[model samples]
Structures are given as C-alpha cells and as structure tokens.
Target: MGKVRKHSDSESDDGEIEFKKPRPAKKKKVETKTAEKSNDNTRDAKGDAIFALSNKRRVTVRAFPNGEPAIDIRETYVVNGEQRPGKGICLPLVQWKKLVELLPDIEEAITALPKKK
Candidate 1:
C-alpha cells in the first residue's frame, strides 16, 4: 500500500510507528553579478539586473518558475553581506510597459494631489 499514517491507538499494539523525517526545503539561489545596464542611470553597488533606489530599496529583474522575467521593486536587508528581498511588488513585463506608458499621466496625477508638509 501507499504511505499510511497510523493513529497512536492503532500503533499501541504494534510497538510504535516509525516515521521518516521531513527533508529541508531547497533554498532559492540569488546572484548579484555585474553586467551592463541599458538605462543611463549609473549602476549601483549591485549592478546588472538590479538597480538601487536607495540604501535599503532597489529594483531587480528576475525570472520566476514560469521563466517570465519580472521587475521586483522591493526593500532589502543585508544578510551575511547578501541583499535579501523584503516586502515589494513584482511587476510583469506587460504591467511594467503599461506603467512606462502611463508615466506622463501618472506625473500629472501626482501634480494634481495637494502638497504635504
């Protein structure tokens, strides 16, 4: 039979049920290698598909399980000298292009908003 889970009451007569330990989850590999960026914006400390928005925030392009590259604009914190992703949005190519196309309108909308001190 396939793997079975026996209740404690059922296993009491048969000594005990030995269960295999669960394996640890595989870790996702992260790279921050340098490469030429098309944008005029100079490369940050972590170059290539990543650009720094500030000391703690940056934008990165990476592919998910589906192999489609998405732009992740997220906050990061250092862990053993590596930048780890934090809360952020991952925009697919289509949405990213739409955002680019709406830059003018977005700017105008921002301009219409009341100023805050």
Candidate 2:
C-alpha cells in the first residue's frame, strides 16, 4: 500500500525568493581639454564673421526711440526691425551685395539677431 500525503495551509515552509543586486550606473566621459579649446575657437569664428561683414562698409546702427528695432533704415543709422534699431544692423547697400557674396547665409544670420534689449 502507498503512503498517504498530508496537506497544511498555514504559511510557506520554504524560504522567500532572493533577487540579485543591481549594478551601479556608469559615469560619462569628460572632455575638459577639448571642450576648453573649442570654446575660444567658436567665439573667434563668430567674431571674424561679424567683423568681415561690418568692415566692408561702415553701417551705422541706432537704438529705437520706443526701445524697439526701427522699421526703416535711416541715412545715418541702420534701422533693422521695428522693435530695436541697432538690432537690425547690416552692411551698406553696396556692402550688402558683397556681404551676400561672402556669406550666402546672410539672410539667416540677420534674421537671427538678438531681440532682447
């Protein structure tokens, strides 16, 4: 005759399941040397581009009376937008042609001028 089985429903006789510990996150690589050099180069490039554009011809820039960019370019001042006068600074008519020749992205550059006073 086979042995009879017993059943109990009080609590788990076996131990609880165990989980593996999570690994630590990896740190990002730093490029301090390369980053520092690139910063100065970037600024120099921007300054050169602006200087080249302005040196071709003297284009005067003025501050708007209402503290916004002016709409029309004055004979003496280079009015750009209605909100700020100097904000729309550009090369003279003759120099504009040259500027466009030097930088095809002149339109984008001018449009991206700062709006803040």
Candidate 3:
C-alpha cells in the first residue's frame, strides 16, 4: 500500500493559488424627477380629499369601521312644497347629494323643517 497524500490548499486550474474578490452588488434604477413629482402630487391630492357627506338636513363625517373615511347624510321631508319636521332617514352622502341634485327646485327648497311641539 502507498502513502495517502493530503490535498494541498493552494491549487488551481493551472496549478496556481487563486484569490477571488466578491463582486459588488448591483444598484437599483432611480425614478425620474417628473415621475417622483407626479407621485408626490397624487399623494397630496389623496390626503386633501376625503369621503364626506354634505346635505341640507345634517352632515355626518367619520371613518368607516373598516378604517375608510365615509359620509352619512339624513334625508329631509317634504309636504306640499314645505319641509316636514322630524328626524330624517340615513343614507350615503353621495347618494343623498345625487338625489337632491336630480330633484326639482320645489323639492330642493324643502330642508329640515321646524318641529312643532
């Protein structure tokens, strides 16, 4: 049996010690100035706007239970071109606004009427 030779540390394809340095990481692409500006503008616009309810009777503004801002409105009553008196029904603000916008001038004139004791 011949002597068992141990593997040498310094060995290469051409039998030379090779020391390899790690390659640098690749850099990410940067967004353009106009793109960044547009992004900022969108963020600002989003921040300024909110889902809110504005109606003739009453306006209620708050965030939804799911964390989204929402508006709830109460509808007004009308009786012979006069606004009826009492608590109104609740509806989404957008719907209420659209209803009023679509309603005739006589209907729009009706607001939260005075309550009689």
Model 1 root mean square deviation, Cα atoms: 13.3
Can you write out model 3's per-residue Cα lDDT over 6-107, one digit (the tens) per residue?
A: 446665434444455566789754432211124424111224222213333543444566665455444444444443324644445576677677788646
lDDT of 1 by residue, 6-117 (tens): 5565535654455766777897665433334566754444443777889788888777669887888998876754666799999998999999999999999999999999
TM, every model: 0.55, 0.21, 0.22
Give the range where candidate 2 is weakest over 10 consecutive residues by summed lDDT: 43-52
What are the runs in model 2 whose C-alpha is more than 4 Å off? 1-13, 35-101, 108-117
Candidate with maximal TM-score: 1
In Å, residue 42's CA in model 2 sits off its true spot by 7.9
All candidates in order of lDDT, best leading:
1, 3, 2
RMSD of each: 13.3, 20.4, 22.0
Per-candidate local distance difference test = 0.73, 0.37, 0.44
Question: Candidate 2 lDDT, tens digit per residue, 1-117?
Answer: 333344447575444444555667896543222112243241122122111123222223323455442222222222231111233353444555565587857777887999887
Candidate achieving the largest lDDT? 1
